[model samples]
Target: MNTILVTGGTGYVGSWIVKGLLDKAYTVRLTVRDKDNTAKFENLRQIALTTKGKLEIWEADLLEEGSFDDAALGCDAILHVASPFTLRFKDAQRDLLDPAIKGTRNVLYAASKSGTVKKVILTSSVAAIHGDTKDMTEQGLTEFNEEQFNQSSSLTHQPYSFSKVEAEKEAWRIAQAQDEWKLVVINPSFVMGPSLSSLSNSESLNFMKDILSGKYAMGAPAIMFGFVDVRDVAKAHILALENENSQGRHLLAERTIDVLEYAQLIEKAFPQKFKLPKKHAAKFLLLMVGWMFKLSSQFIKRNVGYPLRLNASKSREALGLDYIPLEQTVKDMVTQMLDDKLI
Candidate 1:
């Protein structure tokens, strides 16, 4: 069996990828900041036991050079899924951009030096494709695809989107300069589903919690986002790693829905606990809140009431992916939140 190095194997999406890889009987080496933090990775070990695959934890830090070299050695493939993802950030450059861009470079550089590594699957986001909904139509794109990239985002504008764009670009640059490994990027949208671990800190989970907890009690912004199941995202990563023809970027969203529509899905699935937004907040109202909340004011101005479309045909046809329904995805997420007592 080939050994695969999985970065951020204890995270929301990364954990599922580790489980999927283990189910396929791959010897997995998981990288983390602290190898002694058994509580953080114990669940992964439990899952590995059921799958009959081996799990090895290695200490690696994104900021520290040469930290991942030992982990990358002897691995057949690498799944670079570790990146800082947070909505609330004190410094966008320090908190989001630096880690994303630098971490990606470090992983690819290590993979480049590893003679045994053949492929690398990167977990990117739809934020890299188009910064705002308005850019979709402005670019003459009816639906966003892997060929398109975010051009309107900046460190001062939409910092999270900008981070993803820069990181993926860096990955592409590094891959083009090397011949040792092939780079496959999975650009997933807002991923939602049951997490492998009981802990809930993912941005997707936070959004669901806020909705169920009445944070959006008055109304939800009309902003739209593409949604996909976390399981599907993991499966895409696995398929991209194994399939010979799977190269370049794959957009991994099932469909697009507004925030209110998402809230309604959760409320319909779990009526007793989740309170669905009754009204849709006007674009102007969201604009005011965006200013107060320090959200990219440009995001409110561009995406407040627009429909954001993502063309996931490449991932579906190439990887043979059949996306789970948004209703099912939302329900599974709510179920996990309830099981963990987060909601």
Candidate 2:
């Protein structure tokens, strides 16, 4: 459990996990799609130079089979955190499902092949647990938990959610078939915080940018979303790796808030600093004009006006997680983006 292989080490969430592991003096091997792009991981490399942890960069592709075999050699654990998370895609199966599902299968296959690997942590999103906020009412549950599986998303509807569900399911299938290694899933809600690198194209960053840059100045959809700090999510992953009792799935979220509440929090933190949305647009208006915002009518109907709730007792009880307040999360993230001139 000393040497760990981390996929998607350059990503927003993965970078934090890698930094946490590096800070703890663990031998962390990070897999990237391209090793030649030194700037993508220059910050991590500099951190590794200062920290006790050893960092190695290996080039691997999610779409290619046997790509992770070399990187997984002699590794005690694998942290599979790489997956596509964009909303706009031309082909759902090729752009989302294949990379996510096949990527999980390939990474786990490497772990099974590696005799040294005894544990694996997969970064699955809350999207996998439930597709739409409307699902909360339809399923007869007030809050979401680890036991629920997303059943509403498909190739045409919320394809990103569909990809995560299929990917996690594939991981579980492989984990069940093998007896050598154990699988732990970390399902996090809308993660937001100051990313270690400013070059991330994560939807979380884009969402904030859209709000601050006046893309939603007129109004934003009053969508309820579960929020969690990116740093907290990263810590949960490392905690899951270190704690033997951490098994199965753990839901990681701080609290639930609507988009208007989020804007209010931002306004409270920095009064009149940016052109913020004054109110939530009507759901009916969103259903008609959501296409301009890249939201389909079905998306608006299913998620725009629903309340999203999640029970994170397992994370607190099992991982000893004390969530960061939503106010601080919003402030820190906005400050970082502003300092970096990203928005």
Candidate 3:
């Protein structure tokens, strides 16, 4: 009976969120840039056919004003998950910052005007919490939580992190200025697992592909991250939408592990298909590779050999979330990648 507006319904995470909502019998009004792309909405259609919920598609663009107005109307909630994510950017401002910040503003503005909208579930990244691994120690942050924000990132340091921080900050600012809608943000770390659609554009999928394809054959960087399953992340979004107690930021990571450990898990799970990197590359070599690949140089200097610690007890207790293990996530992701021939 309740209809929710889901932006980026065709995306990696958005697809799963749409499926979860439909499975719960929620009428989903999905916003996509192109309404004519039947293939993009095919998965949702199939899911809707089997579920009790109904699905509607709308044309909306983040950069264009009033584009989401129709979709937001008469909706019970808005799930704003549409944002550009890229590790390699030709122009940071145009590619990442503008769309992320402006898109949040557009969606919130639409929600503010919609009298039926009561809450907004935003998909923010862990990058919004800490800019660099060094900041974790420099700022005396033993572990990252919902309270800490990324202050060290700028357009120069880590543009993607900076974009997430600024966008989330803007969401808080907009929510403060109005009482029409409550805001709930989910800050997920590196999200992995089987994607509902076969798309492999997400950075996590790319990383998994590289690992399976032997791109990291020589060795892997010592970088560590708190990982969560894509399904759990979507479940968190839906739980936050339904639970009145859910408020503020929720760090949705299940566990933390190093890159090599992740690869070893994949190898152990599927020894015949996955050949993981046995050697660990030197920090300096990773730095050189970062330079050659034109990646964020800060990725090497700050995070390549560092351990990232995140405290997710609050999310578990508040959201009643049972996160799937990182090993299972990696195994599922690797299996999917192999089936799709992405490796």
Candidate number achieving the greatest lDDT relative to the actual structure: 2
For every model in order, what is the number of clashing pairs? 0, 0, 0
Q: Which residue pairs does candidate 1 place in steric collision? A: none
Over 4 Å off in model 1, which ranges?
291-296
**Residue 223 CA displacement from its true place in model 1, Å:** 0.6
The TM-score values for the models, in the order shown, are 0.97, 0.99, 0.97
Task: For residues 148-231, write the lDDT of model 1, one tens digit per residue.
Answer: 989999998888989999999999999999899999999999999999787648888877777887877788888898999999
Q: Write the per-residue lDDT of candidate 2 for residues 1-343, one digit (tens) a residue.
A: 7999999989999999999999999999999888899999999999899889999999999999999999998999999999998986899999999999999999999999888899999999999999999999999998999999999999999999999999999999999998999999999999998988989999999999888888888897888998999999999999999998889998888999888788989999999998989999988888888888998888888988787889999999999999999899999999999899898
Supply the TM-score for candidate 1.
0.97
lDDT of 2: 0.93
- Each prediction's RMSD over C-alphas, in Å, is 1.3, 0.8, 1.3
The 10 consecutive residues of candidate 2 with the worst lDDT sum are 299-308
lDDT for 286 (candidate 1): 75
What candidate 2 gets wrong by more than 4 Å, as runs, is: none
